[model samples]
Target: MPLTPQRAHLQFGVVLLAGALLPALPLAGQQVLSVFAAASLTEAFNDLGRAFERAHPGVTVRLNYSGSQVLATQLEQGARADVLATADQRWMQYARDRRLLAGDAATFARNRLVVVIPRANPGYVEKLQDLTRPGLKLVLAGAQVPAGGYSRESLRRLNGAPGFPAAFDRQVLANLVSEEENVRAVVAKVRLREADAGIAYATDVGARDRDALTILEIPDPYNPIAEYPIAVVAGGHRELAGAFIALVLGPEGQALLATRGFLPPAPRR
Candidate 1:
């Protein structure tokens, strides 16, 4: 039977409509991978997200970035996170205790602690110990941030440095103005000159305001080396999450991290 032009047009339209809807049908029904990571990983992980999307066109990688402690809390509350990257091992352990993490955490990056002061150096804290000088407003990260823990450890080590700790204790107690929620917050207070000095991660200080603040490098032995760990969340899109983790640990990811002032974990340690 010869088909009329009107019928032929209808058949072509139906075929085109079916083809257009085919690609979305399976994806619309598939699950998306949600990832929770530390705020410090924002820039690097964003790059990783784009790379993951390019590699797995059908999978979506949703990311949440914040303090590691906050991320841990969210995971504990049963938020669906396929991958969790923490700025410290402690949070990973905490998550593991709750069985929220899928596998043993792998250390991906190392960070350094630094004392940052306003660009003008109003406090004259040229060295770490100067942070203990009287009347200087010093801001530190709240106890929850890994940077805060590292800062406390470094301060304790400094205490053993010939009256440094006593001076620091007295000065810090007197001059302590604000304890921010994360390293970036602490850095911001200093950059804005709201606080005379602040302790923050090297990467956090690498932000654009770096020139607005003077960075005081801590000595190697006394400084606490912060390690960032990566793990997949159990029972939540594990395969896709694990792929994201692998990408983070890969060369391309590490290179991106290094450029942002994060150190790759030591080969032997």
Candidate 2:
């Protein structure tokens, strides 16, 4: 029998109907990896996220930045995330203790604490010891924050130094006007002149705020190094999470972190 136009049109219609009846599938390689990271990593991680997306087509990187402790609590409460990056080893250890991590956390970067004052020099704060000046308003991170813990440790080490008073730490604590939730908030308080001075990570004063703040480097002896650790969450996208970690530990990520003032991870034994 010879093929006819009417029969051919009917066959095409049936094919279209069958295609429409099938389940719709996602595009190949399309995936989303949600990352819960420390607030201090905001800038660097954002840049890294973009870079990772560019390198891996059809993949999206979602970032949630907050205090390390805050993020840990969220994970403990069952928030869905593929990876967790913390500003300190303690929080990563906290996650490990709760069985939230798939493997051992890897240290990715390190940072140091610094004293920042408003560009106007409102308190005549030229040295670290100046934080104890009478009536000076000092801002710091909340005691639970990694940056805050480092700040307190640094202040305690500064106390009783050659020129500092015996009760220097006590006096500085007395002058605290605000305890912010994160290091960036402390930077903002000082940058906007809301407080006379604040303690923050050295990287907190980036190029944008360099003109708005004065950064005073803390001596090594009195400074505490903040170590960053990253791990894949137990029930999230494990393969993608590993890939993201590789990018972060690779040269490009390391270079980007260094450019943002973060120190390279300490040598592994």
Candidate 3:
């Protein structure tokens, strides 16, 4: 007896339905990991989150990116975040000093401090020494911001350097344009030519949609290595948070950081 074509089609359809239904049971129970990171990590972490979603189907990622100081303040004020990645260890230390972070954190990336100038270069602030030129507009991050702290230190070093103090007084200190609230704001002002130049992270400058700014690298003799650390915030989603941290420390995450103009995490000294 020849089985009818409709019966054959119905049998195949039933088999397909069962196979599709079998995978749906586990898809509905996936987890979500939330991370609070610095603004500079906007690009890299967003990419990491997407990659993570692809690797772990059904799991979702929620990211809050802002200034490191602001994020730290949020954590202290009881924000719920599984992972907290800071721009520098100082902020993380503050979180730990207050018992905000649960355990030891790992350094996940390093960034270089670079001076950004407007494409217009109206004041002709072209070199590191020119940053201190008198009457040339300049912008810097506020004292609490990581880039500000680094810039202040760099200026001190320049002032102390033999034959450099004169240059610092003439270019950097004299120009004295404005002090910004954060690194991102500093970059933005310079990109808009509101100020002649500004100090910021290389990664920050690289993130700008328009490449209208010129970067002046701090000479090696006075350059400070900037590093970022990741820690788990206490009382947040610790397990999944740790998973996110592990992902940042993993090969895939490191690769993304490198692609975004950051130096890979170095071996502990």
Candidate 4:
């Protein structure tokens, strides 16, 4: 029987509807989860993502790494993502205040600032005080970034140390040759010898870059502990985000973070 025009139009509409629904079909068996994370977590999170995929077949983790402040701004501007992991609690609070989070946030890890220098040590910067040397070039994360805020705070503590002069912090700030948007960028500058030295999270210098850079540990009194937070983003895959967060806080994830130089979260009493 020949198809009438009206019937043909109805058949085409059904086909279009079916096509639209095909992506959501269970047979497709693929789900993509978007994660926005701080730049310092790049390597460790990538490892964790792979572990997650292995445990949950047919799921893929897509990551966007940037400064915590930048990520909060993106979420506020309506960027779609399943999870947000930041280097500090302040930005997580920013998301919560705006009602962008699906549930309470979890503090997963901690980090500390260290001075990174090229393996060659061109500027001969051996200690924190050496950053004040004349003509030395130093790079740091922008003041708005969590790592930057911590870096400045550490310098202030150094200035107040009994042996250090009052102008210590001011002199170190004078050698600033560049201010990057993220801690990873500061590590990159030091690794590439673009700057004599840069302050970065201890975890930012991964195994791959360790050979190219030298880490100068900051004294306990002068170093500020950086707390990392994770939460599910509102209007996203809440279940999946929660699962990922669990994986991060689980034994395997904590072990991985420790191996990568990140400190484990303080035990709850």
lDDT of each residue in 1-269, candidate 2, tens digit only: 67699999999999999898664455335688899999999999999999999998888898999999899999999999999999988899999999999998999999999899999999999988888888999999999999999999888998898898877789999999999988888998998898999999988888989789998898999898999999999999999999999999999999999989999998977
Query: Relative to the unseen true structure, what is the C-alpha lDDT of residue 39 in candidate 2, on a scale of 0 to 100?
Result: 96
Give candidate 3 misplaced runs (Cα > 4 Å). Answer: 1-30, 166-171, 207-210
By TM-score, the better pick of 1 and 3 is 1
Weakest ten-residue segment in model 3 by summed lDDT: 165-174
True-vs-predicted CA distance for residue 12, candidate 1, Å: 40
Q: Rank the candidates by TM-score, best first.
A: 2, 4, 1, 3
Pairs of residues clashing in candidate 3: 131-172, 132-171, 132-172, 133-170, 133-171, 133-172
Clashing pairs in 4: none
- Give the per-residue lDDT digits (tens) of candidate 1, residues 1-269: 78999999999999999999997776685567788988878878888888888888877777899889999998898787789999899999999999887778999999888888899988888777777677888998877888888888888777658646654655565678888787778887888888889888888766577679888898898898999999988988777888888888898888878888899997963
TM-score of the candidate numbered 3? 0.83
What is the alpha-carbon RMSD of candidate 3 to the true structure?
Answer: 10.1
Runs of candidate 2 exceeding 4 Å displacement: 1-29
lDDT of 4 at 79: 96
> Deviation in angstroms for 186 in model 4?
0.5
lDDT of 3 at 188: 87
- Candidate 3 lDDT over residue span 1-269, tens digit each: 68799999998999999998997676466676888888778888999999888877778888998878998998899888888888888998999998998899899999888888887898797667766666778888877888788887777667658657644634575566777767888988988888988888888876454469888888766767788999998987787778778888999889988899889888878
lDDT of 4 at 177: 89
